[model samples]
Target: MACTQVLLLICLWLSVSDAFTYLRVHNKSEVTVQDHWFTQRLDHFNGADNRVWEQRYFMNDSFAQSDGPVFLMIGGEGAANPGWMTQGTWITYAEKMGALCLLLEHRFYGKSHPTKDMCVANLRYLSSQQALADLAHFQTVMTEKLGLGNRKWVVFGGSYPGCLAAWYRIKYPHLAHAAVASSAPVKAVLNFSEYMDVVQASLSRNHSDCPRMVKLASDTLIELLDYKENYIKITKDLYLCEFLVIRSEMDISFLLDTIAEYIADVVQYNNDNREFEGVKGGNITIQVVCDIMSNESIGSPYDRYTNVIQTIMKSKGEKCIEASYQQFVKDMRDISWESSASAGGRQWMYQTCTEFGYFQSSDSISQPFSGFPLSYHVQQCSDIYGEDFNFPVVTAAIQQTNENYGGLNVQSSRIIFPNGLIDPWHILGINASLSSDLVALPMQDAAHCADMYPARPEEPPVLSSVRRRILELLTEWLQL
Candidate 1:
């Protein structure tokens, strides 16, 4: 978690964009979401009249009355799924209140591209402020269209979008009655190394040796990178598909990411009740990792690590073991932007490069591996995005974010910040109250966006209390 702040790019592949993972196991049934679009402005702050684009959204009116609350789920870096309206605690809350459910896609993400292309010139409209405006406008249009303009509304989102939900209530207080921000990292900082610290703590919770062997295997990989003689065995030991072509350090870092993916995935999804109620060990969970670590017959700690890596890679169906480390290292002196994956990773990277600055650099030696240099990520702002993404520009943007949104110390009312105690990104969340109205719940035995997902069988008592509190708050706020 140290820098893989892609919580804008969840997994590290070029195509992967779950940067901050929000599970959307959407089961399509009868097309509940009536997909629609709003004519949104390209630049809410600067665009003139007629400078418009379509923003994607979905609405479900099953539980709606002529006069009822609207439950809005704010989509983040990934595509908006219809399941959000059907699944999750919010839908249940919506059901109880007979509220209409709506899902608004983030502008640069899903099918809500506001510009012709994701070029630097076009992506200027992809700021958080603009996205918030999109929500405000969407609400204005939809509520009015359905003759529900005067009715109360409640917004919801988890992870990065969670930050948006919190900030939305803070900024656009008149648009919605309350918001539920699950694991929202409101604070945008340059160095977010605290992620791995939580990872360390989570592993340590299971058994002392879990994080220890992870570190040992990391060190072994680092030591293996230096010796030319060990190259062949390195491939064989890690079960490489081909001879090591890239720098061993990059390969080592990528492999470390591969390893981190396993540990992080388990901790990220450690809400066992959601997947397995009382079972001690569930698939791809912390217990499973610990079970792997406990296997003494797996030979040395390195071999145990190898077995885990093999399992992870095979699950991903990876044929080769090379890192795409060279893409960001290109000379920015002669760089041109491309409209590739900008709707997803490239757009998230732009947001990260500009405001969040949560680069997942493997700089800390005490951690597993140096994933990427900060400059490599910072430069990629211009390398792939635009020239305005340099360090100076991004630094100013971060300050603006903190000043405008109150990063980590949000002063909003009627918003609930719920963080799973085990989530690596929890370190960035508000685990306490800023005021009587701005409350936070550090949900125990949870990970990532645990509170955002639908409740499961025998849900943890803390989660039950959280759900009850949110429902109560939203109900009370709307009635007032």
Candidate 2:
């Protein structure tokens, strides 16, 4: 799917609490936001190579007091946007606390490219350890450059960056005072089949029949792939831009994975309403998707599935869905920074292949979706980078990551992990408080960083209380 369309689905479904009416709204023209760059080492692990790169960061000091705290929003896999300075509940907290806010774009993402290109050789420098080091160095450099003396720094991030926020406090406890890791997948696994299991659970929570219909649709599509004539029918029904070909298992995986992604995208961001730099949120909720799937007027389960894809494609203004594995490989194979795949796709995939093997596969029988298995993603690592990044290497890397970071057993203080109960990624996040200072706050009816957004009237009461609790924790930590 197109980035904007995916973002639209992501942003539109958010529901929040009613405590953020006091958030200061700054006109874009009023905020004097400027792009700041800091010189950072390209390879923090290698002391021999002295190569440096300019890292991008943005700051908003509109509410800063002389002795106030610092709020650092860590950028994740995607490009960091300056708009976050003015939006999000973090800004609300900053305004209330009179804290200075800063957002650091992750290396190799957005305009903060550490290298000229994203080839396998250059991407070797991209890892979670390197990113954590970037944060430690950034804090030290910025504290001196800005003359910040003994000010408490609170780190905030969602999704992948959320994991980083928790890990940062664990690795460099002296640098940051507190962290808000929202919807963070702290644990790394080779086959994330639980991802789809949660997706089905979320769907069933909305309507029990929805999962049955989704499974039926998937099975029907798989059966159709056996006949050559059904290929043309599937192509026409799904509205593919190219002819559907099932010459290999990879091709079959591509088709099923593409279909599963449409559903997963909705479930992941269902009710998440934060707006991005250039994209606005929509109302494509799980209920909306289930309604489409259950509407027998559309035809069979397979026909309804086709309609789901067509609805998303039409919303994005895409002419046809791309289901060709060769085209996908060709796009990912392009190492140039100018390629469309460079917009976090290739970079994130590399991180998954190396540091985090978070491959969401349908290997489990409990999940509704099927066809794409563990080997499908393992092969992708080999096809995109090289055979060196095979299953054994990737497995070892995940093991090392868990050993280094402590994964679910991460021992960190003054960190609040707020996760949505319905969010698929919550399977790997901390669901209960480990101690008094290290807290796990699970929102009753939330999904994927819903707490990070400004509170809304329709949000569950637990969400309202969670925001208040987060503020309370931050206040207590800063006082210490």
Candidate 3:
């Protein structure tokens, strides 16, 4: 069957959603919202399966004409925030194109979860293939509801969902006229150390000494933690509420994760990019971190990292810093630590372990400070999902995904693959066009989903060009 025409997904906006405080609840508290729900089959491919689920959806028909385009926006790894429905680059373009915009929550995410319990058995239905099926069913029912069965559709998403946009067109072309996949990692990878390599590159671009200082501090910290005597010193320097002996490899991995996460944020969000309007307080850049590290007036490298965490925490206006909070270390030891991360990251963790395997592990190819081994990530899967779902399943899933979807060798057409050159995830994304119809629009100096952010007045020249190209292609697709 032809893939139903979905809206042109601009960007996954993972980083944008991460840092930006676009208040979905408070901003549109009294906007007279028109949220709706539909009954979706739990297993779309099964004829005998009778399980049904109520899926959440939001739509705006004011811009629709009798025979207008259908814009289907998809969410990823988190709840479908109402701000996306109310405003964003996608909605802005929908208005310009006279399209009926619809935002569909991904199954197993947000309020659309099919199962009552988040058990391992329940997450079996959580896959990109299933989510794509939801899009098709929703498009059919929605087109009928709006009396626009004849209208063309385009699919749009960012990051994971962005990969879905490209896959939607490839997997079922008849339903969608075209797709816009921004920052989509179409090729599933196992050892994702390149993500940190890009993090190093991002810091290098900001200032050479930043990454060097980072490596210096990281190696020194790991060495000191090896000795039992330095545990107190490590705790005091990093501002931890308690001292922890390195009982397991996971212990230091957690500490490494905390520090790497902060660096990843700066690079991925370009939090220091003064020209980027979406990221507030351009003070969070790598240069600022380096300045903190280099100052003789400041304390040691451990103290520098503490300041970095404090700066980020202060900007968030939160009283308790996760790095300093006692529970932060406690959760690392918990079985459901993955779930405790913001926006219920457990679902995404399951997806990554089972299908994507984008575990940001450190190898010889990565920075010297990057000591997060492949075993640690594998251990995390065992820690969270138990023993049955082992490394073989993940290996098979990665191989199967590539074989089925064409992976990096996608032969599909009429899809715009926009990736920021600086996005570490781009290592697995479609960086070059496969054909004339399948275009690769690269944001030379942007970060992950940088193009997906709300339109800024001082946009980078490449981003502006890519936006124009996307609008043009979407316009042409609607006409076809």
Candidate 4:
């Protein structure tokens, strides 16, 4: 083809592609109080054309026209339900502070399903980088479609979204006026090693009188590790003896991690499960960690172990008696005693261990872990053990924030990081930059998000101070 003809074809392709793939925004509906939920569609960067990305946000109380600072709310993992307690609770508070609230659901969660096939396809795309991009794109859409041009908003979030909030300001400091990260993971990845250490320290510090109990707990773990084979043997036996059933599909780690987590919980677990028949009245203190970690196995450890031993002996026949169990026992004992750092005793120890690169297993192929998605397992075990379970994605997200935010050379832009002292996830060990624009508030006994509590009769004194600081900063920010 001639040069002129080739140029005309290229131009035609560019125009057609732009028209087809450019981002498009549509207004869905306006709520009673000037709040509107809108959806936007954007073409994927990769040429995966079938995947149409969609995101939603709530614009409340003059977000489009507000001269005051606008509040953009970013939620943590699996926060698809827009009406969840935290978002709902803070909506009115944002309005009261003279700020328009914008709540955006993280992609792959809630109504923000950007792609289909959640398990196989979407899970791969669900990362901190993509989430940050989605938020940025939504900001641009809101600016053009809602007439809130050139007005920067403040980003806020707790738990997982806190990391996003920090990243938003870091990545687009010019787009955000300020940022407020509550219970944010703005430093390291979620280290299970550090988290378990916090749990162990908390237990020992809070319950010094239970030294004997702690020692017994430690000893039990050592014994279990030492007799991994025999322990499995006995557990199998016990399960079969009770139910007269024979199933060799037992996962020993499940039992160990479950019991480990149970022991971490502050409360004692004294239940009447058929599996614990042999040790029903035994002095081993059980807690919620064990129960939550334990999958629904039908039999007891005693029966399960016995069956395993019997099977092994039967299979070996004459050779079984001559087999040296002493070496195996010694190795187990070694792993049990030496491998366990006191910091590794928390119920969510696996999460910190995997994320912070501190976990080691004698046998390969462990359970799926990292204490993510904040399911019932985390909520029950963490709450029972006095351990806070936040979203795990915050780990990578925070590192990105620090890298970008620290390099911005931003001045006159303030960042307020609020955290609860008792929030074991963040672990009361963070070093904030000593800049005039940054303030760190460590609230006492506040748990996680301290701003949403009604002053209670049994509340800790620090809760009052936390509440006070939150009001002070927010009120001053709003000029209320």
Task: Identify the candidate with maximal TM-score.
Answer: 2
Ranking by TM-score: 2, 3, 1, 4
Q: Could you tally the backbone clashes for each prediction?
A: 11, 9, 19, 35
TM-score of 4: 0.56
lDDT of each: 0.71, 0.85, 0.72, 0.43
* Candidate 3 positional error at 82, Å: 1.2
lDDT of 1 by residue, 221-291 (tens): 66777777887877787765566555645445555565566666667667444432222333456766766
Q: Which candidate order results from sorting by lDDT in descending order?
A: 2, 3, 1, 4
What TM-score would candidate 2 get against the native? 0.93
Highest lDDT against the true fold, candidate = 2
lDDT of 3 at 48: 92
Kindly report which residue stretches of model 4 are placed more than 4 angstroms away from their true locations once superposed: 1-51, 56-66, 84-93, 119-121, 149-152, 211-215, 221-250, 259-412, 428-433, 452-457, 475-480
- Cα error of candidate 3 at position 431, Å: 1.5
Candidate 2 yields a Cα-based lDDT of 0.85
**Better TM-score candidate (2, 3):** 2
Candidate 3 per-residue lDDT over residues 1-480, each given as its tens digit = 122222122232123223222223333223334546667878888889866777777766556566678888887788776566656677667767877777888887777767654667666888999999989887776666546767888888889989999999988788888898989998887878888888888777766777777777788778887899987777665555466656667777877776677667776766323232333545566567667767656677656766776776566454442443235433432323134542556778888888888888777465635657877787777676778657888888888888888788988788998888877888889888888889998888787776666667654568877878889988876776
TM-score of each: 0.84, 0.93, 0.86, 0.56
Q: lDDT score, residue 216, model 4?
A: 42
Query: Model 1: runs farther than 4 Å from truth?
Result: 1-31, 47-49, 236-242, 247-255, 272-282, 314-322, 327-343, 363-383, 386-388
